[model samples]
Target: MHAIALTDGLPILDARSLVDVDLPQPQPGPHDVLVEVRAASVNPVDVKQRAASPTLRSPRVLGFDGAGVVRAVGDGVTLFAPGDEVWWAGQLDRQGSDADLQLVDERIIGAKPLSLGFAQAAALPLTTITAWESLFDKLALTDVSHGALLVMGATGGVGSILLQLVRELLPGVRTVATASSDDKREWVRSLGAAATANHHGDLVGDVLSAEPEGVDWIFSAHSAGRAADFARVLKPFGAVVSIDSARELDLDALKPKSLSWHWEYMFTRPVQRTPDMVKQHELLDAVAGLVDSGRVTSTVQTVLHGWDAATFREAHWLVETGRTVGKVVVER
Candidate 1:
């Protein structure tokens, strides 16, 4: 099997950061499926891992989002067969999808949407899981009746699908998405945002302008320096769900408003092998239906055409730029 791997935790500009190598084909575990990876997408996790500490004893493949075909399945795998097409986010502890073949647990994998190509399907799994978990599992958006939802950093992969999900599923709740520019605001608006705010400007003012009162829920994609803004813009007893890391958050700021903050990490279920791990598969299947029905769409912004080191380096470079509208995929 051919694979592109990171030799050490180095910058993407380094020539040895990502390199092509040949490895033995991986075999399936008792509950795993061996997938022939057709396409893969790069995410922030990949970039972070590639540049993180602890240089590896050997190269580690670093892709998380993949759409592929099952070439073989273990005896315990009931959800898919050898010929089934599948999509999934590979577990962090395992070798990733940046290879010709990968072994993934069937519990977290779903049937790829029939309406989409491999590249399109590959662009969704990781972001879709994050967005779905952030809204339904963390914030409990479905239970809220009539309130405003703020989607901070609304031009990224998760925000792209999240806006559509809220619009299609929660009809009563309006959304205010944040973008830094005119074109980005328009892009998020096209994805179903009721209103758009510029993240570079006064975020609280922008959101409050759209909703006279404070918002009921906040989905923080990039939450590093916005803790004070979150405290100010959320209504009393409102909740916030974040997916990023923050070094300095003033917890005292939330006391006055009785604001609750929650962190969402999509890899928890698979990493812990939780009893409800299969929920990821179920939600992904449901999202696939949404895609097939045209309620949701793929967030692939740039599809780089190749399966080599240079291609992946370019993908990482684009993602590291932090200006991409949605996802960047690598297809064969």
Candidate 2:
């Protein structure tokens, strides 16, 4: 099988940061499925891992989001068969989907949406999982009847899907989004945002101008530093959920309003091998159902060809630039 891997963590500019290599085709474990990867997508995790993680004794595969057909399944894998098409964000600690073939736990896999192609399907899993878990699981904001919901960095991968899901799942809930560009503002509006603000300017004022009373929920899909700004716009006793990590946060700012802060890391379940790992599969299934029902749409913005290191690096660069409006995919 052909694979793109990193023998050492280095700057992506270095040609050796990622290399193309040939390895034996991976076989599935008792509860695993060997997928013939048809397409893959890059996330900030890939860029961070490549730049910061130390060199590994073994060359590390570096992609997480993928969609493909099942080539084989382990003896205990009954959920899917050899010919089934599936999409999943593989476990963070394991070899990823940046190869011709990849192995993933059956419990974390889901049937791909019937309406989308491999590249389109590949763009959803990682971002959708993050957004779904952040909003519904960790923050527990399934019922939005109380007030409006604010989505920061609303034009990014997670934000795009998150916006649509909020609209579908929380009907009649007022939704606000922040997008710096005119195009992005229009995009979020199409996704059902009640209002759109500029993240580049005063986010607090921007959101407040739209909803003078303040919002009920804040989902920061961008930086945690934006949490302070989000806190200002949040109604009393409202909650804030963030997927990004920040070095410094003024927790005191949220105290006066009695605001609660929660951080979500979608990979935590798979990284820790948690007891509820199967929930990821269930969540993906729900997302697929939404897509099938036309309630949700793929966030894939740019699709590149080939699964080579060069292509992967280009995708990484686009994401790292912080300007990509949606997910960038790579097809085989």
Candidate 3:
């Protein structure tokens, strides 16, 4: 198998940091499926990993989200078989989906959406699962009919799909999407946001201006450096959800109002081998149906080809720019 691997754990640049390596084919475990990589997407997680220098004895493979065909399945796998089209955002503890073949747990895999090609379907799983868990599972937004949600970083992948889910799943809920510029704001609107806020400006004020009452929920896909500010604007009993890196967050600010803080890590279930790990399969299945029915769509902004190290590096550079309108995908 040909893979883009971290040859050395040094400061990683784009192409210079990643190297193509040949490795023996990986076999599936008792509950795993071996996927022949077809299409993959770059994520902020990739950039974060590349920016660091982790000591490793072997070249580390590093891609998180992918869509491909199942070449083989383990003895315990029953949800899929060889020749099945599947997509999944794999666990963080193992080799990722960035090569000719990768092994993933079938419990976290879902049938690809019939309406989309490999590249398009690859862009949704990771972001969709993250946003879905954040909104519904973590934030307790089971019924937000009369509520409002302020989404930080609304022009990005998870934010884009999240806004659409808010529209389709909670039609009556008001959405205030946060973007950095006018064009990005317009892009957010296209995804069904009810209003827009400038994260670069007075975020809380902008959201407040859109809705007189404080927002009922905050789905932050970016830094919540102003956690206190957001806390101040959230309705007393409202909650906040985030998936970004931890910082010196003033969690005490949320204590006064009895507000809560929730974190959503899409990899938690798979990494920890949670009993309900199959929930990822169910969520992906639901989203795939929505995609096929035209209720939801992919957020792939930039597309590349050649499934090689050079191409992966270029895609990473685009994502690191932090201004990409949506997800960036690369296909073989």
Candidate 4:
């Protein structure tokens, strides 16, 4: 199997930083399934991982979200068969989805949404998992009868799905979306945001102008370093869920308002080998059901040809630029 890998360069941003390698097809563990990867999608984590840890041992394949047909199943795998079309986000500690063949635990896999193609399905798992877990599991926000929800980076992959998920799951809640460009603001508006704000300037004023009472929930999908930025716009006793990395956050700033903030990492379940690891699979299936029922739509905005390092570099570049409206995918 041919795979794209990070072989050299300290902060790799191009094909020179990655290479093509031929490796034997990976065999599955007792509870794993071997997938013939048809298409794969890029995420912000891929960009972050490739540029970190300067020294590469031999080579490291990079990808997490993939959609493909099951080519083989381990003896202990019962949920998926050899011919089932599935979509999943692979474990972070193992080889990734940037290969012709990849092995993933059956417990974390789900049947692909029937309404979407392979490329479209590939774009959903990772971001959908993050968004679903952030809003529902981590924050425990299934109902929006209380107040509005604000998403930071509203045009990104996770935010795009987050906006729609909130609309479908909580029809009565108002939504405030923030984007950097006019096109992005319009995109989120189409996704059913009650209002859109420019992340670049006067975001709080814009949000307040849209919702005078203040937002009840804030989901920061992008840079989450600043606290004062949204403090005035958020209601007292509000809650926040952030998925992005933050180097510095003043937790004390929320004391006066008694605001509660939570951080969500989508890989935590599989990474920690938790007892509820299978929840990811179930949640993914639920998301698929939502997609199939016409309550959700694919967020893939750019689809490139051939799953190779060159094509992946383009996707990585787009993600790093922080300007892409939605997910980018490539087919093998």
Candidate 2 lDDT for residue 224: 51
Among these predictions, the greatest lDDT belongs to 1
Model 3 TM-score relative to the real fold:
0.97
Q: Per-residue lDDT tens digits of candidate 4, residues 215-276? A: 99899975554588767788899988998888877777777888888898988988898999
Cα error, residue 180 of model 1, in Å, equals: 1.1
For each candidate in turn, the TM-score is 0.98, 0.96, 0.97, 0.97
Ranking, TM-score, top scorer first: 1, 3, 4, 2
Off by over 4 Å in 1: none
Error of 2 at 306 (Å): 1.4
Cα deviation at 265, candidate 3, in Å, is: 0.5
List of clashing residue pairs for candidate 3: none
Model 3, residue 102: distance off in Å is 0.7
For model 2, what is the C-alpha lDDT against the true structure? 0.88
* Candidate 3 C-alpha lDDT tens digits along 204-289: 78988998789988888775577887787799988889888767777888888888888889999999999999999999999999
Clashes of each: 0, 0, 0, 0
Provide the clash count, candidate 1.
Answer: 0
lDDT score for residue 50 of model 4: 83
**Using alpha carbons, what is the TM-score of model 4?**
0.97
Regions of candidate 2 where Cα sits further than 4 Å from its true position: none
